[model samples]
Target: MAGHYVIAGKKIPNHILSMGFIGAYAGAYALYALKPKPAQPATPPIQASSSDEEAFIKEFLAKAEAEESK
Candidate 1:
């Protein structure tokens, strides 16, 4: 929805979505060829406490134990 309009102040039809995609791909290609590749910013890794990981393990173990006891 963000880049779905033309700079000429015209509304774009659904069919022109492919054209927008091609233009973006071409721009990216040009950047790749002429510039040093940009480093992606790192996202913070999700940290789970040992207890939280254990809880998930315990849940699966409980299911297995219940099935085994049946």
Candidate 2:
């Protein structure tokens, strides 16, 4: 025989608990799936040129090194 649940003090079948968990999961999934998504920009963002990025990185490292020497 299935033992009584400690909290409820009743013999709850395993199948019932499994069904409850499945129902809860399905309900949560339905809520998430139906939620509206944020709008996206029409135009993509502009990126910096490779040369400009390299220059910025060099400048940053130079400043960091200068500060470390102080």
Candidate 3:
């Protein structure tokens, strides 16, 4: 009997079946080897000094409190 390609209860050509398998294998290898890197989280900008940070926080809190009172 001559060899036949039977897949999913259907008949196909041997070359088509072999090419399909080769393509699938190549796709899997590409995915495994060429996966994209995860994106890095954004870093906060550097502040000049602790005094400047404290002053900004104090002003922000004062403004927030004024808004709440209104």
Every candidate's lDDT: 0.77, 0.79, 0.81
lDDT of 2 by residue, 30-68 (tens): 999999999999646445578789688778877998999
Clashing pairs in 1: none
Clashes of each: 0, 0, 0
- Candidate 2 lDDT (Cα, 0 to 1): 0.79
Better of 1 and 3 by lDDT: 3
**What does candidate 1's lDDT look like per residue over 1-48, in tens digits?**
445556578878655878888999999999989997778866444455
TM-score for each predicted model, relative to the true structure: 0.32, 0.48, 0.42
lDDT of 3 by residue, 4-66 (tens): 777799888777778899999999999999999898866554454798887897788779989
Give the winner by lDDT. 3
Clashing pairs in 2: none
The C-alpha stretches of model 3 lying farther than 4 A from their native spots are 1-3, 37-70
Q: TM-score: which is higher, 2 or 3?
A: 2
Cα distance off (Å), candidate 2, residue 11: 1.5
Q: Which portions of model 2 miss their true places by more than 4 Å?
A: 1-7, 43-70
Residues forming the 10-long window of minimal summed lDDT in candidate 1 = 40-49
